[model samples]
Target: MGRRDIDESDFHSRPTKRGSRPRTKQRPEHSDAVTGLVTGVDRGRYTLLVKDPDDGGGDGASGEKIVTAMKARELTRTRVVVGDRVDVVGDVSGGEGSLARIVRIQERTSTLRRTADDTDPYERIVVANADQLVIVTALAQPEPRTGMIDRCVVAAYDAGMSVLLCLTKADLASPDELRALYEPLGVEVVVTQRAPSDDETDGANSAGQTAGGMILVPESVEEVRERLRGLVSVLVGHSGVGKSTLINALVPAAKRATGVVNDVTGRGRHTSTSAVALALPVAVTEGSPTDTFDGWVIDTPGVRSFGLAHVEVSHLLRAFDDLDEVAQECPRGCTHLADAPDCALDDWIEASPEDERPARAARLTSFRRLLASRTGSDA
Candidate 1:
């Protein structure tokens, strides 16, 4: 075969002018940028609520308007989530077809995060700056999964956010069992039952409310509304739970879709595909005005699994105030599990007063269950 000639010019590296220009460390300040709350994130676009200075103008603007924005090129690696307080630049007028640029993401007070599974290292931030984590669990129909609830509570504790257990479908099953289990952990429990139809006889239950007289609204919907007022809360649960139904009751304008539990699998079908933050009404009463309040409720898609791969044992212990103090005296490198050698939790439980020993022991058992879950032993 004849020898082929190779192009030496192709082998020689050519200097491109792309990086020849000196790059400055300093970037634009964007002082005119206005702060906005990220209401929803879809694809690469973010929906933000920004204050409109000309809100009361004859243009018929409200105090705030919804603006769609994209992340700045400099923030290519940053993840912007719902409930994030961000500074945006560009056409923030929020007018039709107006798009803005999110230049900066402010520091988050709290970040709710999860992994795909217990062994997954990569973490996904569910929401940012949310002060409360509302875990919705059904008492019947689909059946309540304590494992899921425990994991959620641990995540909230790790994130330094308060946890609220919202039990739904009370009419189908009693919440007394679940209430006794979580209330001792200092977690607030709210039992919400569907109102009875007009054909049902009017009778007062344990909570002192006429089921027939009550409208379609859940009896404790007002309690949940008050807890969510003046704060940012994120609702998470399995598919069949009534997270969307509760959100609709809290904010009539939300209109989030609700789904039913699979008859065979006993799991809920996914209705919401992503996280969305909705503003609460100033007064959520039946005939109140249409104005919005300062509070926010972020409804996330149903999660089948909540991974704690990024959570450390130390952080998990901190979530249990009662156990954390006793855990401090344990031997170094203790797992705080039941089989741990010379674990202080076991000793502390035994040392408690006779009247309090049962309660303390129960807390210890609950804490150990959560600790075991992190090791992928049970889920």
Candidate 2:
């Protein structure tokens, strides 16, 4: 009478396993895949610098060729951004009208990301495998926002990259205030003011010659160059911060369009629409025959807000090695916010001598401010 009672597993679990399906699907080896570095990304196209097979590289000379490529159909969901190292197949020749297919993306060493706003859950990858983050802020004209700078610094630290604070338009204002704020955090600060161009200073019977005007090079430009010499740096800032101007000055051949600040609104016009990586011009010595591509500069479009909703407290803390060590004494599962009970950071700051208190307090304040930002708070 119990014949009707049965289970689905009874029929599937049989003595003979021949009827079962294969456990795994075979994937292609792609042994002949060619490697290329992504230099730029358009709507659906990618500009890659393919390494020459025959060349033994010392800084990527003529052996590397720039090629245009598109993602292979199988990689429909993958996002290929600038600074990505990818494996390409088919038509890798960097010839006229030649296009290739990117089949696989190599593991990234680092990825910088930001959200549209504090509440946005979606994160956009700013750049991949960048070694440094250059936060460009204008000292005057459009004015600088310390909040924006803090966000950029946190993003850099979260991505495991070094930070550089580049204050532009020093002619209009002094970098003293900003420098004092960031220097204690161990962020390198470089201040620059546009040097007077020759045309502006030439007094050869000029009808109207301004003594000081815009110049191609600034006083601190050389220092900035030296800092960026061997690192892959990405520049980020809000609109009208002179990011484009700084880029143009750094790479003369870049020819990136510059915009003017609106008189009433105090905002700089957006110049760069997309992020593009440009090779830094190599330095030449008298007896040297080879040219060395020193580094790459990735110029990104200006953003009004840099959201950090996707970031976690652990990731942010990792950026501050000193704080991370002090945090080990904190209670288990400590939030480390300003009001967290028995938070060790508070005691750590108090234990410091009187002179060191101010600087230590500033760092703790900055860290907490960033932590507050993660939860959509302005604290």
Candidate 3:
């Protein structure tokens, strides 16, 4: 679940439409509608994937993953985002594509979006309902930006998702030294260290094999694939952070084009084309049997700058839940910034000479700094 709020009623409500289609072409009513996940969005339509709707109520699920074509006219005004679990009202024949009407869109767990840069013309939704935000950074070449990592972590925290830091190219940089920057923030830091283990080594050599979570990968496609098992992870980083390289490595046949970090400008050339999800299998444990579609990985385009002015200051302070109590002590209408006249608990801080008001003040200052640096109008 995430904190990004959305209008609930609109989940299935389609806007008033004024178009007519051939009634004779409409297929007969299906027995009972089943749910499916929206995996792809294209050409004013959606590609829905549904588990078997027959068998023992949901039996024969082995070959039930069907791709149905859905249009906005039938879905009303509902904008179906990727990962949307929708109920379809039509034949879901897997072999032959059939027209579908998105009758209902199940509530989402979260929605990830970013304000378009000052140069861009519109807001961009990276993906929806992701549980983790992974910031993949490199050690050398383009270099790591603590500022960007901090922003992504803050966004994850504000959006109520786990934050992980993945440092690539450890061969060139000291993982211990570089990882220290985010280790204190409780972020899971994955460094490119250690050789592949027996399982990882074996899996790395095989094209399709079961793997575990967070496996050590050393220039091995299989190792990377196994590590991503059972996760709804979204990768965020600069252009040259090896997001696409890593994706291609894990899914060798993906043939995802890779680009070099601009030597002169210190930026990554865009690859991957568009943001899309790659499903992964989760390692089965205990009584639960393993199956496909256990996890998902979403890759997005590179960014030079990530402005946080679109986010609220209250949301920023909330990132550190441990410190929220102190913020609650603020005076009514407190901006929580330095030297505010309305901080109700000002006397408490002032009485304690050793207290660090500067640090507390700095946290609130981030919003102002974001605004000053923001482009165009965001308010």
Best by lDDT: 1
Local distance difference test, each candidate: 0.82, 0.81, 0.61
- In model 2, the worst 10-residue window by lDDT is 202-211
lDDT of 1: 0.82
Q: What is the TM-score ranking, best to worst? A: 1, 2, 3
Q: Give candidates' CA RMSD values in order.
A: 7.0, 9.5, 12.9
Candidate number with greatest TM-score: 1
Of the two candidates 1 and 3, the one with more favorable lDDT, higher being better, is 1
lDDT (Cα, tens digit) per residue for candidate 3, span 210-293: 123223344443344454666677888898777766654454334455667788998888876666666653432234333444
Q: Please, what are the lDDT tens digits per residue for candidate 1 over residues 237-306?
A: 9997877777776776676776677899998889889999887765555455646565778999999999
Error of 1 at 100 (Å): 0.7
Q: How would you encode candidate 2's per-residue C-alpha lDDT over 330-351 as one tens digit per residue?
A: 9999999988999999999999
Flag regions of model 2 displaced more than 4 Å: 1-25, 54-61, 198-213, 216-218, 282-291
> Compared to the true structure, candidate 2 yields what TM-score?
0.85
Cα RMSD of predicted structure 1: 7.0
Off-target runs (Cα >4 Å) in candidate 3 are 1-31, 54-64, 74-77, 118-123, 193-229, 251-255, 282-293, 337-379
